[model samples]
Target chain A: MADFEIRDLRASVEGKEILKGVTLAINKGEVHAVMGPNGSGKSTLSHTLMGHPGYTVDGGEVIFKGQNVLTLEPDERARLGMFLALQYPVVVPGISMTNFLRTALNAKRGYDGKDKTKQVSPKEFRSLLKGELEVLHMDDSFLPRYINDGFSGGEKKRAEILQMAILKPEIAILDETDSGLDIDSIKFVADAVNRMRGPELGVLIITHYTRVLQFIKPDFVHVLVDGKFVLSGGPEVADRLEKTGYSEWAEADEPAVLKPEEVA
Target chain B: MATVPKVDVGTDYKEKYGFFVPEDYVFKAKRGLNPDIVNEISWMKKEPEWMTKMRLRSLEIFRKKPMPTWGADLSVIDFENIFYYLKASNKQSTSWEDLPPDIKKTYDRLGVPEAERKFLAGVSAQYESEVVYHSLQKELTAKGVIFTDTDSALRDHPDLFKEYFGTVIPPADNKFSALNTAVWSGGSFIYVPKGVRVEIPLQAYFRINAENMGQFERTLIICDEGSFVHYIEGCTAPIYTTDSLHSAVVEIIVKKDARCRYTTIQNWSTNVFNLVTKRAMAYADATMEWVDGNLGSQITMKYPSVYLMEPGAKGDVLSVAFAGKGQHQDAGGKMIHVAPNTTSTITSKSISKAGGRTSYRVHIKMYPDAKNSKSFVKCDALLLDDESRSDTYPYNDVDAENVTLGHEATVSKVSDEQLFYLMSRGITRSEAETMIVNGFIEPFTKELPLEYAVELNRLIQLEMEGSVG
Candidate 1:
């Protein structure tokens, strides 16, 4: 069975339909890349899957570990091992990153039936955070600073990946994590994600460009257009789209289930 | 749509801390305030003639002065119906076991005795209109440091007490001050001799257990040259349908090169009016800090002030106010720079929820001689729901051209995005809000002692429960 599955997912924002009849599935250890042009509902799908309050799920079935996720709160969905690395992480002034991450990690552990009332000890949390910071090549000073309050764009993205590393979600969705990063920073983030990938973890990278995929290769690449996946193939699909651009798929009137050769 | 989980927010702090045991008092004054009632109080205390005359003069002022038509609504306050004085115990004791069982039980339930044993250098517990219990560490007393109730201080250290009592906040300063002066009873009085530093904090706990009680406790602290002291005071009242009144006047004098920190955490019941007058004078090279947290009371109007009297003097006021259902917290700070090179900073944080209202009314004044002085005032108000309201009223009067004065005020609602972000991190909406609110007031709480800071956060979390959907 799939670790996470979205069947005929339809959603809207403020009465305007965004994710219309979207369907996808990801099992543990698999990496699925959904590439699309701007305003093609790339972020809508990620937000809808994570149950952002702004997006209304008009009709959908988001199943995580054989349970309907749409019926749960965002925090509930998060405890069920679903994580969304927001494209633009929000800044919470005076809330240290260490405090937030520890609270989140403890919440996840609590939901996993490991003594919900017990929190991670300070020494344990410190060592865990230090290890993850080293993995992401982040400075230790970032731990005490307010969560993303004055972080640079690259720093914010890297922090999101660090959170993923700490939480170790079963299904991780990265939404435009590579949008605002230098080449070196992109490689750092990609390397961190690649290191965390294993049979117990499923990855979904949503992006408008294929540059990030070069470092963190995906098992399947899907072309999303007009709120639906028009094509699906192996990693070659991303390479072909990189050469051909998304204009052809975006300009099509109807959803086209094209093969990798057809796109080429 | 996912239904928001319902968590029980009911914690009966009132039942635990508000239960009053019936005890026969030594004396109880009439419900009305007049010259006769004032004289009776002074005569009951057996105060000096000069103190009695001061009480008479303050009574005249209190009677002649009209209620100010600004800030909180005072029409609901019925001064005539308030009991001017109530003495729960005849004499103050220096030991917890010596105190009356009822009074001792009250403070024990409030955790006053535990706090004293754990951290405090001394403690003065006031019940109704007088201090029922008082104690201090022998080492502090041996170092020429005096920590006792104000009433006892007047008798024990009359010379020093007479020189500084009511000096910073005089009776004529305001109507409430005048009223407090006319009927003031029990409060903390501290004197740190020159070059002495009281490393541990001296604490005082005030409780009003009677209905329609008017508690007017006058506190006076004097930090001599090169001395240092930190004093903390906390208050709570039993729940009652009829309103009670707490009008206190606290005055402090920080001498040259001395430092003084005064902290107050007042958590009155909803049927209480808390109007207090607190002021400090910081002399040359001296520092005076006021760390205030106002959490309860139906209506509160307090703005602790400081006056920088000489060069190199500094004043800092950090305050936090949490106004829950049917409460109005009109609290802020005031700073006055009277000499050159003086500095002051005021930070106010307020939260309103469940149709409550909070307002920040702060004033900053720089005199002509206060050249090169700098003052920064920041006020932030957070409203938890649409029904809650907040307001900021800042008055900055800078007469000196060379002074740097900055004021910033922000009124914000807990943003949906911030809440959603925290909720997405596996925290419930209510828990996330509690965290944000705690962080918002971290600047003020961080200044508090560890125990007080932890208690403040717990109180705020209790107030924030069920506040978000």
Candidate 2:
């Protein structure tokens, strides 16, 4: 059964509707790719799922383990095992990446309030980060740098992957993480994500191109056009859409379904 | 709805610093300032004749000088209801009275051990490890460094005390200085001889100097030619004051080729009016740096200044101000370049929250004779909530065409994007803000001495705890 379900989730940015009637159901161990062009609401879906303050929920709900996750704070959603690798990660000038990650790892483990159980010791943190750093091919030098400050486009993408690898979220959304990266960097990011692929994790990779899909290999590929998924199929749909742009499916208002005939 | 918590800064202030011991003490003056009170304060200290006369003259100046209408709102201060001088014999430290449990709890959180917390509270006259302090004092004395209280200096080393007492900042410089001079009682007096360097910061000795706590404390330090010293005073704990007025005068003379750094981190009660006059003069090739951090008081109007008096002299001032609710920190620094080849840098960092307000006001000048001089100033303020406010008033007068001066000011609120990014990583909203605040003041905190930086970080934690509830 699908552990994470998006039931006709609708959202808005600055009073204008963005994600209208978007739906998805993905359980752990399965990797799903959300392919869309610019302004197709891929970012809106990811940000709304992670509870970005800029976006407001117009209707519907996001549910994980019998809880309407949209009503929860972004941090609460995160503590309940949700992650979004932002396209443009914020640049916080003085907070080092290592320090931020340690605080984040501790928070996920319920460290701050009363029950300080499973708190990540500094010793354990260094070793845990060392493994993910090796997977992302980043040196210890990256640890001291302020989060996303002065990082190159590819460096930012890899840093997001590093966070995903460290936090090891249950269901992850990669929002345009592959937009600016070159082929080699995209391949490395895919390799890192593939390594984290286990029965404990599910992923939603949102991008404008299928270059990332070629490396990450999604079990399901959905075409998001005009805020909702206008078409759904297997890997073949991505190839066809790559050849033909999103203009064909951009006018659809309701979500398209993957029929049993297509599945057969 | 998670029940939006009201953002309040320094909410633990009362619980931490507001408890008072019975104000009954021997040799205490009545609440108010007058000519007789000044004379009584001077006679109580047994000061020299010259110092006594100066105190009388300063009292007249304090009466005549009009209260300047500038910076923060000083109208709330009830001068008539303030104790001019109080020489309380050690109640918590010496007598049978025990230390307050809450203050003791704060000391424990600050990691101050059993024998030292009372001394830090300024109620203890002696430290249990007197020999340890004595050995350090012996080294300083051997190096010809005289570290004592101002009253003792006025009585014992009258000649040296008279030489530099008000030379840097005269009583007429400001009304607060005049008031401090009139009733000034206990503050550190240090004299470093030529070419000697007191490697260790003199804070250990300062904590033991129980007389450092007067409503009007006068401090004087002189670093002789080619000498060096770093003198730090005050701690993170809230000082107990029967009166709400705290006007201190700190004067220093950095002689030729000498360098001196004076560090002060004061946490007075929120009810206090902290008006301070601090100034220093650096002679030829000398360097003077004022590292100041103020975390308390209802209204604090202080601008630690430095005058570059000769060629190649430099002045550096780094100030940190945290203004919580019902507080206004109108603080900055002054760099007066008077000679050739002099340079100075003034950096101000302030954080305000919960309807608190902070203003960074700086006055910098380069004289016509100050050719080839340069000064750079930067002011940054962070507002934690929408109700908080911050302002920058910069006065840069560059007279010499050859001199270079630059000023930069930035007022920023903790951005929602920055907070969201951190919170999305599973850290709570309050914790995320705390991280951002600690980051915003990283430049200032990094400059603090190691122990001070540690204590400052812990203080940040306490402030955060108060911020959430």
Give DockQ for candidates 1 onward, in order.
Answer: 0.64, 0.65
- Residues A60-174, candidate 1: write the lDDT tens digits: 7988877999999999999899899999999888788988998898887774324645778788888988888998999888988898999999999999999999888999999
Give me the iRMSD of candidate 2, please. Answer: 0.6
lDDT of 1 by residue, B1-469 (tens): 1112122223542255342233342554468888777876776666777788888889899988999789899997888998777664422224544433433343344355454421111122233323442234566778988877788888888888888887788889889999999899888788899999989777664322221133788889999999999988873322222227889999999999999999888776566789999999999999999999888678999999989999999999999888888899999899999999999999999998999999998899999999999999998999999999999998988898788889888998888888888888888887789889988998888888887776667666656763211
Which candidate leads in TM-score? 2
Query: Candidate 1 chain B TM?
Result: 0.83
> Which candidate wins on lDDT?
2
Q: What lDDT is reached at residue B431 by model 1?
A: 78
Task: State how far residue A37 of model 2 sits from its true place (Å).
Answer: 1.1
TM-score of each model's chain B: 0.83, 0.89
DockQ of model 1 vs. true complex: 0.64
TM-score of each model, paired residue for residue: 0.87, 0.90
Alpha carbon lDDT at A76, candidate 2 = 95
